[model samples]
Structure formats: C-alpha cells, structure tokens
Target: MTGDERTTTVGQLPTPDRDRARLPATLTRVVWLLWALSLVVLGLRWWRGEGWELAGVVAVDGLTVVLWAAVTFFGGIVHSYARRYMAGSETIDRFFGRVFAFTLVVLVLVAAESLVLFWLAWLAMGLLMADLIGHVEGWPQARAAGALARRHFLASSALLGVALATLWWETGATTVSGVAATVDGASPLVVLVAAGALVVAAMVQSALLPFHTWLLSSMTAPTPASALMHAGFVNAGGILLVRFAPVVTVEPAVMLAVVLVGAASALGGKLLKTVQTDIKGTLGCSTVGQMGFMLMQAGLGFFAAAITHLILHGFYKAYQFLSSGSRVEHTAPNGTSDGGTTGPVGGAVVVLTAIAGGALFAALTGKGTALDTGLLLAGLVVLTVMHAAREVVRQSDVPAAVRYGAVPLVALPAIAVYATVYGAIEGLLVGLPAVDEHAALTPVHALVGVAFLLTYLAVDTGVYRRSRRLYVALLNAGQPARETLLTDTEDYNEY
Candidate 1:
C-alpha cells in the first residue's frame, strides 16, 4: 500500500477508492463464534440421530450436520489465521467480510432443499469468491484472474440451474427429495440432460479439466483466501453429487461418463503439477487431482467414500495452503543406491503389502467384497497403498529386512484409519440413499480402469519428461492467462 491508503497503488495503477483499513479481529471472532454455534447444533443433531425438514425448502440431515461442521471448522481456522496475516493490509476488512459471507452462503447451500435457494446460494458463493480473488484492488493481474474465475463460476451456476429446472419440470418436484423420489419414472432424455448438467457443474466447481485455468490463475488471491477456497469451496462439487446421487446414478452410461471425466482430471492434474514452478500452483494442481478421485468415488456409487475423501482433503489442503510459505530445507536425496530403486524382492514385498492393505480395508468396511464398483474402489486402495509402501521402502535408510517389514507396519495402520473414518461417515450419512450404493462394473468401467492404470504408470515413470510432445501439451494445458503474469517492471524515477 503506497500513497493514500484509500487509493492504494500497485505499480502506478490505482483501483477504485475504498474506506480506511481496519483490524479484522472482530470478524474473526464472529466467525469462530459461528463455528462454535454450528458445533452445538451438530451435537444436538447427533444426539437426536435423525434429520428434519422445514416446509420442503430446507432439509437438515446427517449429511447437513457433518458438512456444516466441516465447513465451519475450516472457516474458523482460515479466519483466525487471516486475522494476523492480513492485519496491516489495506481493505482487510472487506476481505474478511467476503470470506465470512462466503462461509455463511456455503452453510445455506448445503441445507437448501429447494431448487431456488440452492441455485441462489450457489451463485452467491461464487460471486463472493470472485470478490476475494480480486481483493488486491490495484493489481491488473488480480482483477483479470477474478474476472476469469467469475466467468467459470457463472457457467457452473448456469448449468446448475439448468439441471435443477430440468429435474423439476421432468418430475414436477421443486424440492430435492421430491425430485429424487420421482426421477425414476421421468423421461430418459430429461434424466440424461440433468445428470450431465450436474456432473459438468461439479467438474467446473472442482476445477476439473478444461475448466481448471481459473484455479491455476487464482494465485492473485491472498494465501488465506486460497486456503479457504482450496479447503472448503472446491468440495462443493462432491457435495452436489452426493446430494443428487440418485439422479446421476439413474443411467449406467452417465455413471461411466462421470468416471471417465474424473480419471482424466485425476491424471491430468498430476501431469499439471509436475510442470508447476511454484508451491501454490503445485498445491492447486494437487487439489484438482484429489477432487477427481473424490468424484470418481461418487461415480463408483460410494457416496460415503467421496465424502470421506472430501473431508480429509479439506483438512490437508487447508494446512498445506496456510503453511505453504514455510517450506522444508533443500537437501540431497536420502537412502543408498539399492534402496533408491526397487529391486525384485522389494517390489514383491510392496505389492504384497498393498494387497493385504486392500483386504484389511475390505474386512473393516465391507467394501470390495463383491464384483462391483466397490471392487474398483478396493483396487484404488491397493494402488494407493502400493504407492505409499513403495515410497516408504525406497526412502528408508535401513537394511532390506526392516524396510520390507516396515511396509505392512506402516501401510496397514493408515488403511485402518481410513476405513474407520469411512465407516464413521457412512454411519453419519445413514439415511442417505446413496451412501453405499453399489453397481455392477461394466465394460466401460473396465476400459476406464485400464486407461487410468496406464496413465498412472506413465506418469510414475517420467514418461512425460521423455516425450517432448506430451510434456509440451501438459505444459500448455496448465499455463494461466498471459495477463496474470507480470512481464515488465515499472520504473518510478520519472514520477
């Protein structure tokens, strides 16, 4: 902030004038107080162990309680952190206000039972996020980023409207539950359109492929705003899917399409992350990948698993974004030459541990016990465990015996924790129709599964680095708008 604070300048560009900057302590306290109140509501809801409806426009259920708790928890953390982080900046009060408003709108969004409130809340959330993105008043790049984001958000909001309206017209039901209940007998064309619209809306909200540039260019937002967006805001997509699971699950083709979209983004996000040159960009791309997996879980007919991923991802990304500035020391790689690369024996051990991890997950959660989409989920667990176990064995500065033994010791506990959380969330979402809805795995799924595996292997092997075309495509795909980057320095001596 230079010159008059009311018209703070960035490189000689003065934005519209604003009121004097004020401390954000009061707003931060208010958000925390709201979080506390939400927790109290959650406790009462928990004790009651059932949901209620109000005039068919607002519904409070297990999903609502848990989601509200998660939203407010993340909101409280971001607000507290921002109180000190943005204390001295000009326009800090508005930043806090937008953030608070965004949080409240999200609370409204999840509990909304009718199409009108749902759509309105969705649009309001996006507009608030756009304001937060453009909080740096005088930076042209920041303003451009915010506008770009607003366009994408508006598109998402529009699609959501189309989805809800089509469902309403087809089923003659204005409320979410009513739509779900009557959707079975609706025309297939209407179902297809509504489901497609819903999935695309989720993709846009979560920053999936072809709709991710906004997030990539959103570095203009303050780190705290980034944290809030990455942590709680992006999860809107998954929440939308879980809320409308019945609609999307109506057609096998739609579910397959959802799986395909998610796999593409999951793999593409990893590719994009590899090409990133900065910490925030890397984290943003990582969120994209994580969201893809969450959507994939939902498409696989395990809405509980998606919610679990969404909640865990919120906690992780919030911490990653808030603490991104404090990075680890740069040092040479660890471990001996033999341990660095996997030998046959080490590979065998890792693979075995991963399979065992999957089996344990199945036993604990009753998922993947049959030949359905759940089996694919179990495969994902195996893949995840295999990746982690391999890394653990490869990085340990110990003898082969201990390293191999450590795979099961560490991987099994992690799998147990994940299963425990999944079970708990499934319990919380007991009344939801799609909590553990399992469908038969079809040929389309098989094709996608194979492609997903191949993409993973290719990325894991540095194939992108070797193939110039592939690398260039991914690089170009992930780049933000040219205007978002500073190209020249201004010389102030003339002034």
Candidate 2:
C-alpha cells in the first residue's frame, strides 16, 4: 500500500474526538472548583486551630490539606487532559467515573482521622484504580495489568489492616491521631511488629523493588490512567509514612530497615530506568526510583523533606505523563547520548559543582534539620549540577564564557526553589503529630550519605555504559512477566 493509503487507514482508528467528551470535561471543571473550595476551607480551619471534624472520626490538618489539594488539583488536570486524550475510547466515561471515585476515596483516606475509615478508604482507592487500569476491557494486557495491581493492592490492604488493628489493640485508639499519641506508651514488641507490617504495606503500595511489576505492566492502560496511577495513587506510601512518622521514628531498628530498603529500591529503580526502551516504562521506573528517594527521606527522619518530594514529584510526574503523547519525537533512542557526559573532565565538573552547591545549600538551610536531610540535599545538588552540566555540554559550540555563566543561572533557581519548598514544608508541618524529633548527625548517617552520593555519582557518570549485557538485562526487566502471560494466553486461545 502507498504511504498515504496506510496513513489514512491508521488515522481512521479510534482517535480523540473532543466534542463527545463534554460530560467528563464539565465534571472535571466542577470537581476542580469544589476541591479548591474544600482546600481553602480546610486551610482556614487549620489556620484557626479548629480543624473541621466529620462524624467525630475524620479531621483535616495541614498534612491533609496539602495531600488533598494535590489529589484534587492533579486529579482535575488528568481528567481534563483525558477528556481529549481518551476522547474516542469507548470506555472514556467509565474512565472518568473511576478516576473521580478514586480521587474522592484518596481525599477521604488522607483526611480520615479514624483508623477504620482510613483503611477502608485506602482499599477502596486501590480497587478503584485497579478498575481504571482495566478500563479497556477487551484488551488482555489491560486485564492482566489490572489483575496484577489488584493482587498487590489486596495484599497491601490486608497488611495495613493488620497493622491498624494491632495498633488499636495495643493502644486502645482507633483514630490516627489517637494511635500516634499513644504510640509512645504502647508495647515495644507490638509496635515493632505493627511498624514492620506498615512498612511492607507502604513498600507494596509505592511499587518498591520486587513489588513494582504492577506499575510496569500498567503502562498498557491509557495515558490518563497511567498519569493518575503514577502521580496520585503512587504517593500513598509516602503519605502513610508521614502520617505515622512519630511512631516509626521511635523504632531505631525499623528506621534502619526503612533506610536500607529505600536505598536498595531507589538504586534498583534508577538502574532499571536506564535500560527501558519505552517512554512509559522509563517513567514508571522513574516513579519507583522517586518513591524510593521519598521513602528514604522519611526513613532518615526528614519527614518534611519527604512530604515536599512527594508533592513536587506528583506534580512533575503528572505533567510528564500528560505531555508524553507529544514527547515521542524528543525521546532519545537507546544507547545514545542525550547530551550526558562520559568523560573524566565532565565527571569532575559534576562532582565539584555538587560539592559547591551542597555546601551552599547546607549553609542556607542550617545543615538541613537532620543528617539524612543534609545528604539528600547534597544528592539533589549533584542532580542539579549534572543537569546544568549536560545543558552546557550539549551547547558545546556556544562560547566558553557563555556556557560557564549559564551554569550559575540554571543552578541558582533550582537551589532557591529547593530551599523555599523545604522551608515551607518544615513550617507547615511543624504542629503535625507523629513527627519524630530530628536527630543530630551521627557517624552511621554520615557514612550512608557519603556512600550513596559516591554510588549515585558513579552511575550518573556512565560507569555502566560499557556493560552492555547488564544494560540490556535492565532494559528488558519489565517485559518478561507480561510477555510470558500474553504468550501463554495466545497459546491457549489458539488451542
């Protein structure tokens, strides 16, 4: 067939038709307004130190306000985008309904003061998202992905329920705030077991490490659904940690475990991210890595930093997924340089810039509220420096002076934004319950920080560029399970 004929045939396949998307589009706008008003009311109540209580079981606080605002805002944006993105899809209305219902559940989960309500909302949110994942009903891939998600979510819900039940039994408190208040006096063994269960639940919900396949498989779903999954629901783990910070922080062993797990998952996800060929796969892995970092921050007793990271990452991921349809042309092919550096000099520049920027940040932020926070700040500095360096390197033909000058111009705003957001979170969450007191820098924390920084720098500098086998393995890691399932299904169908 001629190119024109093929193009016409392809164009006739289901394409977005905005005219038919009116219901979802209108609902999106109305929901956005309602949530905005809810956020304002919640914020005012928090300001007045009279947080609104519902049914004597739910209460809204700063954390609730911030998280609910994120869900509503991003939820609206995703819906609006989906109105066009999923316009011609047969199940577009179902998609919108599921997303709206999921958002509502998440808002309730975050704002729920009662432990029972929180757990129920959490489960409902998961099921709703799973429905969203399988919205393209006839697609086997969607079904498989949704099934995987449901399995993991069900496990998470079970574990969370056990943890909450344990907490209630031990503390005689059924409210989140009440349980947190009673954590200090609870039996050590009970707290430890409950904390461990909660950690596992968070790990599953956040798609950390071995439990991450659901997220990868979920790319088969529509882009809007993928966006919501990554940007909104994936944050549950971080929120869980933040909510129970006081209790978890007190358990040194649990905190240590959290740190180790988070570090492992962060590194694993990042490495796997480097190898993905597809855009959605890469973004999914990126979310996994970002979740690891956020959890790591929480583990390190930087609850405020964790919250900031969660909120910002949510916004960033939503934007990425929404704009991904337009980014196909910009995606770099595998094994190609997208202006990143591999040379020794480039590596040196990256290290030096990281140190200088980290020092400046530490100075401005007063050593960052905790040792881990300082390390996180340093790591972010490295990332910012590397980004700026890549920009300069990519513009190699530009005047040397211009390139050097652009570094500061680029780095300054990033630093400023980081400092501003970190400061704001610290201020906003000051009165939040369950926050552990920030510990001073310790020898162990320092070592972990240094080790993480070195490892990250090595990876960033392309030390693995020559390891083609490893690269290929990492790139294809996400496909095996789905491929196997699909193959088996096809074989069965043929028989």
Candidate 3:
C-alpha cells in the first residue's frame, strides 16, 4: 500500500464498539455560531468604506472567527476518526493539543496582521495552510503520532519563518539603488554583483552539482511543503533575476552571467531528473529546468514570457502535488502514471491545442502587421477550435466557446495598448529627428517579425527537434556530473 493509502486506511477504520459517548449539543451550536459570526463580519466589511485601517482590522478579526469555526468543525471530525482507528493510551488529548497549537498560531498571525506586517502575515498563512491540510484527516498512531506531527509541522513552520525573516532583513537594509550606488552608482556593476550572488544561491538550491543533496533532504518534508517549494519558492531565485531586470539590462556582464547559469541549469537539471527514482526528486530537478527557462527569459528581457511561464508552472506543480497524494498513496511509481484523474474534459486538451496551433500559424502570416487586423480573425478560429475541443477537456460548466474565446480576445486589446505605450517610450528615449508616427512603428514591426520567426523555428524541424531531445536527455540524467561527484566525494571523504 502507498503511504497515502496507509494514512487513509488509518483514518477510515470504522469506530470500534463503545458505549455511546455523546459530545454536548452546545458545542455544535457554538461552532455554527462562530461560522455565522465570521460571515457577518465579512458582510460588515463590505458595507463599510474600504479604508485600509478598518479593512485590515476587519480582515484580521473576521479571519479569526473563520479559523475558529474551521478548527471546531474539522477538529471534531478528526477526534472521532482518531478514536475509531487509533488505539493506544494516547488518544484524544494529543490531537486536541496539536489542533489547539495550530489555532493559536492562527491567532498570532491575525495579531501580526493587525500590526500591519503584511509580509509576516503572508508567511504565516502559507505555513498554517500547509499544516491544516496535512492534519485535517487524522490517521492512526503507532506511537505518539500527535507528537511526531507537531515536531515536523512546527519544524517546517520554523524553517519558513527563518527564511522569510532573513529575506525581509536582507532586503530591508538597502534599496536596489543603494546597492547600485555603492559600486560608483553604476547600476550595471550593482546588478552584476547582486545577481551573481542570487544566481549562485539559486544554482545551489536548484540542485545543481555539489548542492543536489538538499533536494533529497527536502523530500522528507510533507507534500504541501514540497509543492510550495517546487511551484514558487525554488523558482524565486530565477524570479529574482527577473525582478531585477531593469538593473540587469544595463549590466552587460550580469546579463551574460545570467545566460550562462540559465543554460547550465536548464541542461543539468533535465539530465539529473532522468536518473532520480523518487517522485519528489524528479519534481525538484524539473523545477530546476523550469526555473532555468525563466532565468533565460529574464536575461533576454522577455518579461512577458517569464511571467507566463511562472504562472503556468506554479499551478501545474501544485496540482501535481495535491492530486498525486505525494508518495503517501501506493499505486504508481511515477506520480503522473497514477493518482486522481481530471474530469473528461481534461482528456481533450490535444484537440484544443491543435486548434490553437492552427490559429497561431494564421495570425503570423496574415496581412497588416501591428495588431494585424487579420489576427483577430485568426484568434477567432483558434477560439472556435478550442470551444469545440474543450467539451471533453474542460470540466467547467461554462460554455467552452465563451471560456476559450473570452480571455484571448481580452488579451489582444491589452497587448495592443502596451505595444503603443512601448512605441511612444522608444520615440521619447531615442529621438530620431523627424521620425513620424509611422516611422516609430518600426520597433513594433521589428519585434513582431522576430517573434514570428522564433515561434516558427520552435515548431519547425531541425532546431526544435534537437532542443526537445536535449531537454529530454538532460531531464533523465539527474544532473550530468552531480551524481558522480557526490559518489566520488563520499568515497574519498570516507577514507
């Protein structure tokens, strides 16, 4: 049985024969009362002016009520379930104790938020949210299960707290400009040094050679922790590079360095993933490669591409963790091969994708570049195909036509607006004497032309095929030389 199966079984065992022990009806009433109070608070917040101070207070107090309600409801369920499945001298008290501690932590978070420490508030939310999910369904305990859960949960929270605190302190001392000013006010030099440190740190955490062990050590963490790391935290390193894009662009040396690290991580990460047998291990390395892509985009000033990659990868990684049961359930070797199935609509993504591809082709070749009015027709085509195909692939009740067509159409206007703004900015920055509006359109045309070419190459034979094959090879290797270095280092040190 998988770890998940074992836990579920422990939670699911029927309540053993026992004299009817009924909890007071008053307790149930109180739980309902708290839930009602929370809703009322939420309504009042909406009714009142959205003042930051008032809203913050309402949010804090309201969330407290909500947390209390959640604890009462879920805590009761866990107690009964534990009583049924977990047999030992250690039963009811331990479960309540841990639950109580968790509730207290929630209370502390509320108070912190009231103080306007938004960053701390976010960190606390993330940590508590993970723990709540992990312990909501109580499992049987062989020995001190409650204690074990507390220790691990608290340790995870502590780690999160420390990391965030360090970040807050480090980022607090100096603004990006201040850092730059230190090196003769040269933004390039500042970005070079700062981004260099971030790149090194990111490489280490991403499990690049000589630092791959952390990924394995991290696997022992709960699945939620793993998910957060994969989806966001691990990518923070690369994201940091993007966040500093304004500075990096001015710093030629830094941009080149970013390119090198991104290339190496992308190559090395894919190779290492291929060799990793553990599910989470594979995820860690995959993140390394994904992060590399984002870093490369940053280096190349492709902010839109980096943002797109980040959002998509985040959801995908999180869904993978939540659905796969995180090595807890024993079914498939690779998590993807088993676990929860998406509804039927998920199965039809391929058809929708083909439609999208066709639309993309039409848009690129259509006449009148610069919003290319014909592309609207092309997008419509893509939308139609997606609508037809989404019937089987999308589980939403919303009409696939409305859903698929709406977002891209909205995006078109936004992209055009941004493009216009970009053109104006270029005109201002580089005053080409007597350059008319039509002449100013040159940059936009050139950019679109380049993008069109690259898109074609990505789909075309030769280069695209080689890139995919290389990506696959690297993903399988688990890091080209990291494994060998680890083994050799271990052997030599033992002597």
Instruction: Assess candidate 1 and give its lDDT.
Output: 0.85
Q: Write the per-residue lDDT of candidate 1 for residues 396-468, one digit (tens) a residue.
A: 5778898998889989998999999999888888877655666678887777778767766676555758888
lDDT of each: 0.85, 0.76, 0.42
- Candidate with top TM-score is 1
lDDT of 3: 0.42
Q: After superposition, how far is residue 285 of candidate 2 from its true place, in Å?
A: 1.1
Error of 3 at 473 (Å): 9.9
Which regions of candidate 1 fall more than 4 Å away from where they truly are? Answer: 1-23, 328-339, 396-406, 488-495
Q: If ranked by TM-score, best first, what sequence of candidates would result?
A: 1, 2, 3
Q: Show the colliding residue pairs in model 2.
A: 246-434, 275-475
Query: Model 3 reaches what TM-score against the true structure?
Result: 0.41
TM for candidate 1 is 0.90
Which whole-number lDDT from 0 to 100 does residue 154 have in model 2? 98
On TM-score, who's better, 1 or 3?
1
**Overall local distance difference test of candidate 2:** 0.76
User: What is candidate 3's lDDT per residue for 72-183, written digit by digit as tens?
Assistant: 3433333333343333323333333443444334334433322234334334534443343233233222112223333443443444334333333444423322222233
TM-score of each: 0.90, 0.88, 0.41
